[model samples]
Target chain A: MRNRQQGRVIVGFLAAPVILYTVFVASPYVQAFYIALTDWRGLSAEVEVIGLANFAELSGDPVFWKALLNNLVLLVTLPVVTIGVALFLAFMLNAAGGPRSGEIRGVRGAGFYRVVYFFPYILSIAIIGVLWTNIYNPINGLLNGALRAVGLGGIQPSWLGDEKLAFWAVLAVLVWNGVGFYVVLFTAGIKAIPASMLEAAVLDGASRSQIFFRITIPLIWENIRTATVYLGIAALDAFAVVQIMTGGGPNDSTQVGSFYLYQNAFSYGRFGYASAMGVVLFVVTLALSAFTLRATRKERIEF
Target chain B: MTTATHDRVSPQAAAVGPRRSRSARAGSSGPTIVVAQAFLVLWAVVSTVPLLWAVISSFKSDPEIVADPWSLPKALRWENFARAWDAASIGTYFGNTVLVVGGGVALTLLLSAMAAYVFARFDFRLKGALYYFFVAGMTFPVFMALVPLFFVVQNLGLGNSLPGLVLVYTAYSLPFSMFFLVAFFRTLPGEIAEAATLDGCGEVAIFFKIMLPMARPGLISVGIFNFIGQWNQYLIPLVLVSDDSKFVLSQGLANLAVEQGYAGDRSGLFAGLTIAMVPILVVYALLQGRIQAGMTAGALK
Candidate 1:
């Protein structure tokens, strides 16, 4: 009787979720591969399979290449810059407090600083895009307004309209939106370090920089690695920000892969061609995840 | 090598050394702290000033805004918000968003908790395989599934409907919820479950009456995370629902900004942005601690 009841409970609990996952998440993922081979415009029931045709076109698609290149630039730069700034801020917040009588405590109002920094992460990406677009407006935006207020009007360029500045402009927003979460993340990692270890280093006449470089980073390396992977994934799928802010550009200059795929599928109605792009992104995402995990591997340092 | 040399030189007699170095450390960190504080202040300003500017600019007329963006509003124009809410249909979009996100988060939590509970507690056939199947969904980006998923939803006749969007949101959210909550359920003690079972409790009853209540904190954390995610969701709603009346706030606000290009309701547009932002801001302020913890919890693993 007990075994029978257990079976009933298990089956009951798993059924809905199983169906939902299979129908929505799992099936779509599997079908994307099959869909990539066909020239299905999605307006008709007919799908003509053209083997390796979509991939061939993708290689020759210059706009797609530009998009991928932008993603690559973001993947490299976003993690390094965000992590570097966050580490500095986290160390300062958790350990850079003027040491009071041998115990290394965080700075004054660390909680306040954290709350302030993390505000952007909670806002909708759409809200951020809208807000930043206005801020970067050449004539009446706050960025230029501030620049002019400070008598630097000559350098106030149209941020989103200029092809050269647009991609970097979007990237800066990504970094801005991302840094706070890592700050809170790294702060937690730093707080986990046993007080005795830090005190020992302090007693041994380690400078602040010495303590940060030698003690803090190595202990939080796992957190850093986790952060790198998450940020890398985010950098790959920067669709909403690019779409809302630049709409793939002043001249396709700020195009990223995910947004480009979105454009091809929805705007252009080339479902088969877009699916091929999706498949390529799938491979790149897998490869990047694997490469990041392997590249950031360090000998585990037990606390 | 540094540890060895330090140990050899000190012979474990450096307890008082920090006090001696206090003045020297202060001399160095004093200047550094000032610079660091300066940078932190600058960043805080950078983080918040734009948002404040938006809120402030929402109260200014177009002429005032264009003439001097930096100047304070001559008078608070509550009409801008009125225009955004009524004329631009932000109110409708806000209601739709609340409905969809509410349904989505509720369904996600219930289904994820059920699946997670079993994975955490039961030892069944294919259990490892099943758990990993759900967990594996978290690794891939969602855009890969978009084209096919669009067809799948439309085939099910869910296109442009709120319930359809809710179901899709629940499906997408399951992976992370399962990953987070499975670990959460494993940490729960099994003794209460066993005791409840011995007390003539049905297997389902034991789970609902005893274990579910016990997992409140985990549920709350995952619930908040899901709430924020579904609330701020853009790409899915952008794809699934195209009707203006049915659009979520993010999609609707994006539409509003685009529509305002030459229509010159700039202040109204800012008002709509402010309207969409206020609830999130208020909630974040109220539950900043819990929200921060919940959001960052997934990264700790």
Candidate 2:
């Protein structure tokens, strides 16, 4: 009797979340997969099932390929640049230490710098997009203004206008907005490293460069891997920047899979096609995350 | 390991070249560090310049903003904030956002915490399978679900409603919130709960009186994260809500910005943008320490 009652309680406890998850998350996912194999245009009740036809269509879609390639480009570019710069900044801040660290003549304003760097992160992407739209404005914008100031007036370029430059410009905004979080993460990771380890190395007369590459980097490998996976997933999931800034324009040059999916579902009402794209994106993200986990998994060093 | 080699050679180099290259080394090394600092500072300035410009422009006349986009306002136009708030019906949106975020967060915390506790404390069959099932939800990009989700909501007659938005947000945030809480609840001492059980305390009793209080920090952290995510949510609400009265702050701001273009009499829009950013900034500042600690907790472990 007691065992049965205990079992009942456990079942009751698990029921709510499980049901919610099943209904909202799992059910929708299953429905998405089903819709991917159909000809539903999101409005009419009438629909036709076409097994793998949407996938076949996607195979030939040039915009699909472009968006996929843009996502791939973002995946490659963002992680290295954002994480590298963040790690460097974290190391510099860590090396500087506390009050005395900021009191040093050149580093006197480190606290102010940290806040300024992190400020962009708090703003919504809509704001960031709008802000950058003006900054990249061909007429009376900062980029053009600076070019003129530097005597490169003739080289003033339309940043978001040209197809080749649009993607890179968008990528820059992402990196700028994202770097602060990684900086905070890396800084905390660096702080968690024992001071004794560094002291011992210094006592042994180790050069600064030797200590960093051999000791510090190895210790923070987990953070580096985490940051990489995060940025990779972020690149895959990016939408707001592309949506607001270019609306995946310049002839779909800036289109990413998410933005493309949005356009298909909302603008074109091609729900079935968008659902197929969503499935592809899901598979790609899952594969990338698994690959990252596998690559980063090794002997865990207990410090 | 390489420090031994460095030590062995350092004395010889110092003895042989004490004064020969001191000035040159200083000149070269000093400039390098200076250049690096300069670059970092420049990056920081560029990142913040737009926000500063926005805040200042919120106070300026339309002509002034057009004249010098980067310059400070000649006079503060505080009425822009009030005007924008009234014009955009931000009051209604604000109320709806609060309802959705508050209800969603509360439901998420209750459901996820209870579920996490069971997973953490009980050794049930299919536990690993269930845990992995929840984790899989995290792996799926939400954009994929947008179409079907809209259908589901509409089918259930929840379209264009605040409750529908809350329900969707709860579903979306559940995976991570549960994941965090599970990791957290597992860290609690099992013996305490066993003792309560031995004393004939029911599972609900112990959960309410003991585990819930103990899990306060984790719950707070998860709640804060959910609040931020749901508060700033744009995509879900944008799709789920067609009625202006149901819009969240983010969607409202986006609509206003798009309607008025980036440069159009944007003093009011800037004020709206600043107003939208203020609540989040204040909350983040107030809970910055706890939020940062919570974020790093899992990694450090």
Candidate 3:
């Protein structure tokens, strides 16, 4: 009797979530692959299986190529810069304090700094996009206003309007928005390192930079690798930021794969063409994730 | 919230320095520490000034914002917020978001909890496969599903409606919520559940009366995480809902920015952005420790 009751409970518990997941998420993902082979306009019930024609078109599409290239650039730069700065800041906040009576300490107000730095990470991407778009405004913007106040106004450029600078400007916001979470993440990783190990290094007359390089970094390698993968995935989907801020404007300099896919399906109503791009992006994301995992694989230093 | 912060902080404090180890004490000059302090202070300012500037500019007149970006508003003009609320319909957008995200987060927690409890405690065939099925969704790019998902929603006649938005949000959120909560439920001691089972409790009754309450901390963490995620969501709402009156906060704010930025209602745009930021700001201020833990907890595990 209890066995039968447990079975009923399990089925009842799993039924709604399972059905909802299948219809809304699982099925749609499966269908994207099939839809990619079709010439579906998304306005009609009719869809024709064109057998890789959309992929054929995608190969020659300059905008899609440009967008993919930008994603690649982000894949490299966003992780490197954001991780570099976050590593430095995390070290400073958690371990860079001057030794007090041979004890390594985080700088004063480390907790306070952590909270303030994490502000951007909590806000919606839309708000971040809007906030930075206004801040990057060519005229009457905070950045330029600060520059002019310091008497460097002559070098002011139209940040979003200039195709050369637009992509980099957006990338800067991405880094800014991401660095705080990693600082906290890396701080936790650093905190996990045994204090005795660090104290031994200090007693042996190791410099701050020396201890950081030789000891702190090796132990936190897992955190850094995890960060690289997450940031790489984030770099792939620079959709919301690009869509809200530039709308793939300034000569399409900042077009990203996800945003381009969005435009193709929503703006142009070419569902088939967009699905092709989606499949390519999905493959690249999987490959990058696997590559990051394998490339960053190292000996686990058990503590 | 208090417990989560204390749990994370105390261990680090004990690890960083123990006065009992007097022999290990070392000292360095003050200049290095000062420099590090200055650097961190600079970054904190960099992180906050744009937000502060936006809040400050929201009160300025349109000409004042254009003319003097840095100066204090000559007078507190609350009218900008009013105009955004009434004319631009930020008020309506705000309500729609409250309804959708509230419903979405509640549903996500309940459904994920029920499923997660079973996954955690049950012994059954195909359990691993079913759990992995949910976990696999974590890595699949939501972009790939957009084309079919749009049509799927339209076919269900949930197109352009707030309830449809809630369901989609809940669907996408299930993977992470289940992953987190299943691990969470496992961490819970099984003795109390066993005792309840022996006390003539039905499995469903044990879940509602005992297991769910025991899982409160985990539920709260996952709940806040989903709340913030669904509240800030952009793409899902943008694709799923097209009706203007049904727009969520993110979509509404983006539209307001484009429309008002071009319409030269600069102060109004600033006001709208600030208005949109309020709930998040308040939540963060109150439960920042929980928020940080909720977000990073998944990545750590």
Candidate 4:
């Protein structure tokens, strides 16, 4: 009787969240999947169930492919560079030690460096896009100005205007803004390593390089894995930055999947087609997440 | 001969030890130190340049901004801030942002924490499945549900309202928030709650008095994260809210920037961007240590 009573209390505690989740999160997904099969124009009394027509349209939609490609590019570039650079910088920060070392003169500025590096991550993407737009402005922007300063005025090119460089340019801004968070993640990971391990490494005649690669790097695999999965999800869900900066423009070279989905649903009012695309994105994200979890699953190393 | 073998081993160790020390000492000394300093300084400058450029450009006249975008402001145009504020109706937008973000954070923490507590404290049939059910919600991309969510909001007659946005934001953030909080709550000792129960407290009271206070750090961490997420939310508001009066800072700023045009006075745009960024920056600056400490705690676990 007491055990049953305890179970009831637990169920009562869980009821609100489960109901809320079902209503808000899970229900919408089922609804979206249903809507994808119909000719729903976002608002209308009459709705037609067109079967796989929406998915059919998606298969041929040029913009959809463009957006998918953009997402792919983001997935490729962001996770590797952001996580790698962050881990590298974190390793550097950890090795430098606190200011008491005084061996590295710049170590005093570590706190300031951390804050400054993280500053951009806090700002809205709209601001980041606007800031970068000015930086990339062909005529009077900073990049062109620097080029002029360096006597390379003739090579000044339109950053957002050029089809080839526009995506890469926007990506640079995304990368610059994103690295700080993972840096913090990896820094925390690095700091948690036991001092005794390093002392033992020293005692074993291991050089600094060998210690870093073999010991520190191997130890922080979990952090690296977490950072990778985060960056992957972020890449898949990227919308604000592209939407704000290019609006997926310059001949749609910068069109990302999420932005495209937004455009379809809200701008073009192709609700059904957008729903199909959304489902595709959802599946891809799920698969990637599953893959990450599987790949990163390993026996935890005890220190 | 045995002594000779010992001497051989000892001498090998002795010979390698000083060389290692010498290199270690040199490695910790001047040249590498200079290199590390140079690298950090370069990275710092690279990171700060865009922000500095934005701030400085905001102070320049329109013509000057266009003519010399990278130069020091010839004169500080403090009026740009006021102009942008008025033009964008930033005051209204700021209020709306506070309402949505604030409500969203509160609701998220309240609901997710309760759920997290239940998941942590109670075990029942399909408990693992129930927990994973919530975890699965994290994988559902926001864009996927945008269409139905829009319809759901419209059907409920809550579209374009602060309450509507709050509902959507809360729903969206719940999965991750719950995930983090569950881990945190699970780490809490069950003995406290058990003791509270033994003291004749009800489950609700035990949660409120004991578990809630214990989960403060986790709640704060999740709260700050949700605050940032909701504050910076763009697409949800874009789809759900059509009224300019109800626009959040992101949409408001974007409209202001577009209206101002690329050639349009960037001073006002930059000023507006700066205004948009201030609250987030302030929150970050205020809670940075907590944020770092919380993240470290969460990750290192």
Model 1 pairs in collision = none
How much is A294 displaced in model 4, in angstroms?
A: 4.2
**Candidate with the larger lDDT of 2 and 3:** 3
lDDT-superior candidate, 1 or 2: 1
DockQ-based ranking, best first? 3, 1, 4, 2
The residue pairs in collision within model 3 are: A101-B25, A101-B26, A102-B25, A102-B26
Interface RMSD of 3: 3.6
Per-residue accuracy of model 2 over B1-301 as CA lDDT, tens digit each: 2455345434534553534242233222333344455566677877777776667777887787666555678788988888778886666667787899999999999988988888888788898999899988987878878889888889889999988887888888888888899899999998998999899998899998999999998999888878877887778887888888778888887777787774475678778777777787677667776655565554444
Estimate the TM-score of every prediction: 0.96, 0.89, 0.95, 0.89
lDDT of 4 at B263: 47
Residue by residue across B74-172, what tens digits does model 1's lDDT show? 999999999999999999999999999999999999999999998888899999888788877888888988999999999999999999999999999
What residue pairs are clashing in model 4?
none
Cand. 2 Cα-lDDT: 0.78
By lDDT, the better pick of 1 and 4 is 1
True contacts kept of each: 0.73, 0.44, 0.77, 0.56
Which pairs of residues have clashing backbones in candidate 2?
Answer: none
Candidate 3 residue lDDT tens string, A1-303? 989999999999999999999999999999999999999997665989999999999999999999999999999999999999999999999887643445687887899899999988888999999999989887898888888999998978898889999999999999999999999899889999999998788767677788789999999999999999999999999888999889887888999999999999999999999999999999999998999999999998999
Candidate 2, superposed: residue stretches over 4 Å from native:
A96-116, A140-156, A295-299, B1-36, B296-301
Candidate 3: residue B287 lDDT (0-100): 94
Off by over 4 Å in 3: B1-29
Cα displacement (angstroms), candidate 1, residue A5, comes to 1.3
